[model samples]
Target: MAKILVVDDEAHIRELIRLYLVDEGFEVIEKANGEDALAYAENQSVDLAIIDIMMPKLDGWDLCKELRELDEMPILMVTSKGEAQDKIKGFKLGTDDYLVKPFDPVELVLRVKALLKRYRIDASSLIKLGSIMLDRRTYQVIYKDGNQVTIPMKEFELLYKLGSYTNQLFTRDHLIEQIWGMDYEGDERTVDVHIKRLRERFAEFESDFKIVTIRGLGYRLEVYRD
Candidate 1:
């Protein structure tokens, strides 16, 4: 059973979420504040976390950042704020997904399941997208014809991260924080430059996978499957 940590300031809201999650066969740990939730996660094993943004002590934003720094567990942020900027901020903070208040419990469950699946796919060191194989251990890309190419470290890391979760959108800020260190004082265009090189390097492998530019957003890796 997957153990889920649910943090919210409201008692009734926590109970509602817990009831639905428990019914879906998930083991839930409910915390009324972010402080308690962070303490529990430090010592115990938690598969995922559901956080409310308006908590009293340590709001959801800070909690999400702290949790992400600790580990790679998927985080689902719940808040009444449905603004685009709020969502972007949450993504930048490393929250895997977001849900608005008064959301259907069924939709919440589905998002949780999808996030778990996506993370499971990303946890592998070796990701095979069609005939292109990314080996993180060696930082190499292997082609279908048994040809292997070792690219620049940053380019390889960027490619591997995208290929890990095909079709999942990643913001530029989020990518920078993940690939480069959080303290990186470089331009976001650095990601664009690396992405351009990856695209040029793998131009011949378009049939295998393509790094898609999501215009105002960022990017996602689309793998063509037979």
Candidate 2:
């Protein structure tokens, strides 16, 4: 069973999440404050974390930052503030998803399951193409020359998709669906932007592969043979 850490200051809120999560066959670990949650996360193997922003001691934002540094598991932020800035802040802090207060229990469970599914999809945690080593666990890329490059979430997913299948063409719409999701409102140009960013980042190191653009089709990873 997957272990989930539930952090909230209110007893009822914690209990409510526990009931829903437990029903979904997940093992829930409850914490009353961010301090306890952070400590527990440090010492235990947690698959996912459901954090409330208005907790005592360490706030959700700080706690999320700390936990992200410690683990690569998915994190979902729960907050009463529904403002766009607040959600952006949570995303900037490395939260995978966000939930508003008064959310449906069923929706919460579904979101949690989806996150777990996404994280567990990769059979190999580390994928190597040419001289580039992509660590799926931490999303860090290491070059053969010992230089480490950090990639953003979307860019990293795009690179992983292409790198995992060297020389396979991926259409713009296909990449959009795979990385940005089916509900993405952005145009195909979003793929172009991410691809550009990936190319620039890879250029910083002496990489043996390059992301090639296919005219009128999409892109692929081209690896140079030794």
Candidate 3:
């Protein structure tokens, strides 16, 4: 069963979220303030977290920053502010998604469902392309006969995105936006560097998966036969 931690200052809202989450067959834990929520998030084995932005101890943004340092579990922020800046801040902090106050319980559950679906796919730990396997969680890629290739996280994120969306042409900006996020302040050419590194690793490991650059566009992952 998935464990969900809900943090909301208002007792009613917390209860409402907890009820729906529990009814959805998830194990739900509730906290009333960001302080306690941060503590549990830092120490406990929570699969997902829903934090209220406006809280007494620590605001949702601070809590999110602190928690993200320790865990990458999906975090859904609930706020009443309804500002684009606030939403951007949440996403920039690596939050999976955000919601505003006066939210529908069903919609909340739906977000949770969508988040969990992506989480499950990500947590699979194995990215299979024909006979090649890339494990993001373990940072390992093995050939069909079990040869190993080592790839770093940024490279892995890039390769994972490529292999996940095989044959889809993504420009440098698009790759930066999806892989790095909109608020990321980095050079667009960094994508080229990572791609160069990825190709080197793939060649050295003699893997059948290759990343191809689309001249005026960007790169993609295709089977060696492609």
Per-residue lDDT over 1-226 for candidate 3, one digit per residue giving the tens place of the 0 to 100 score: 4788898899999899988988977789899888898888777878888998888989888888887777778899997855667887788788998888889999999999899888883333467876778877677777789987786888888888888788888899999998899998989899999999888876754456678878998887777642
Clash counts per candidate, in order, are 0, 0, 0
Task: Note the Cα lDDT for every prediction shown.
Answer: 0.89, 0.86, 0.83
TM-score to native of every candidate shown: 0.52, 0.53, 0.52
Task: After the best TM-score superposition of candidate 2, give how far the Cα of residue 112 lies from its true spot, in angstroms.
Answer: 0.1
Model 2 TM: 0.53
Q: Which window of 10 residues has the lowest lDDT sum in candidate 1?
A: 118-127
lDDT score of model 2?
0.86
TM-score attained by model 3: 0.52
Expressed as tens digits, the lDDT of each residue in 111-177 for candidate 1 is: 9889888887333256898888888867998877988889999999998899878999999999999
Per-residue error for 124 in candidate 1, Å, reads 17
lDDT of 3 at 51: 90
What value does the lDDT take at residue 36 in candidate 1? 97
